[model samples]
Target chain A: MIILEYLTVIFLLIGGFFLLVGSIGLFRLPDFYMRLHAPTKASTLGIGSILVASIIFYSFKGDGVSIKEFLITLFMFLTAPITAHMLSKAALHVRQPPRPDTLNIDQLENIRDRK
Target chain B: MLENTVLAVSAAIGVSLLLNLWRFMKGPHMLDRILALDTMYINAIALIVLLGIYMGSPLYYEGALLIAMLGFVSTSAVCKFILRGDIIE
Candidate 1:
């Protein structure tokens, strides 16, 4: 019984580690596109792990195996990238200027042809 | 052991949220700010789940679900507005 609790805690600790890594990546990444990779990947994994741990703990406690936790994980996985894609597309459509060194071939050629 | 782990995980999540808050405040671009907000929602949902586990109750799960669903809707709406300068038209 105590061992089971210890295992659950270990899972939670791992999840927290992933969350920390995700935030660090979000802070340190260079551009919007690069930064997009961080929170979606790291944070989603972190949250999913913790949710899985919760499910396990509850199941062990005879709580009848809640499936809502899995639903949340599925929802987050499905939505996070789609949201990022929508935001990136919107950024592009609005002509939010790319990073100064951005080597956008079409944009560069268009500018060159214009002048 | 379990109590210590819970405390540690909560502290770590709290620190991560603080880091996200810094991004939200300091972001140079609109999308960066939006991304920060989006990430904050994810963190909040995780915290809610953690809270449920800590308190040994299932009630917080409903709150987490609402946060997840509403967070997605609000984010998509903002992204749409950013693109079109109008949300529904």
Candidate 2:
């Protein structure tokens, strides 16, 4: 009973913290590829935690287990990486410039040229 | 307890949205703008989910789900278009 409240609060705080970290990382990162690293990892975890909080609250608040949050969680987890991959590939295809001295930039060049 | 936590969390999400918007506006390239837009939609979904929790109803869950699906598809489609001149092979 009381534990559920504690759990929800903890989850909400965790989610909020991660969400802020992700956005701040996105804003502060130096390169487009580096920037891609921020939101996909941090935001997914943030949203996952928040959805977990919602799932826990709703499951106990009602007679049946509210399974909708699971769907969103699963879908987010599955798609975030794919979206990031597509965006990065597109960036590479379009020759979106990266910060000078970016490590292994030649590898990216190889990929771009392979196509 | 949950009520106050929801308030605080929603505030955090709002601040994040503003940051994303700043990135979108000042981005140097189309991909940067797309990235910012991508981050924005995720934050929006989180905001909607937070609202549903605050209201103590799952009424907004459907909207959240739809946004999740649509955001993914739209982002992917845009990426595809930018990758190749045409979306279809």
Best by TM-score: 2
Which candidate achieves the best DockQ against the true structure? 2
Per-residue CA lDDT of model 2 for B2-77, tens digit only, reads 8988999999999999999999999888888888898888998899999998988899999988999999998999
Write model 1 residue lDDT over B1-89, tens digit each, in one string. Answer: 66667778888889889989999999878888888888889889888888888888888988988999999999999999987789989
| TM-score for each of the candidates | 0.89, 0.96
Q: What is candidate 2's CA lDDT for residue B16?
A: 97
TM-score of chain B of 2: 0.94
- Model 2, A23-102: lDDT tens digits are 99989999999999999999999999999999988977875788779999999999999999999999999998888898
* Candidate 1 structure, TM-score to reference: 0.89
Compute the TM-score of each model's chain A versus the native chain A and list the values: 0.77, 0.93
* Native contact fraction per model: 0.81, 0.90
lDDT of residue B36 for candidate 2:
89
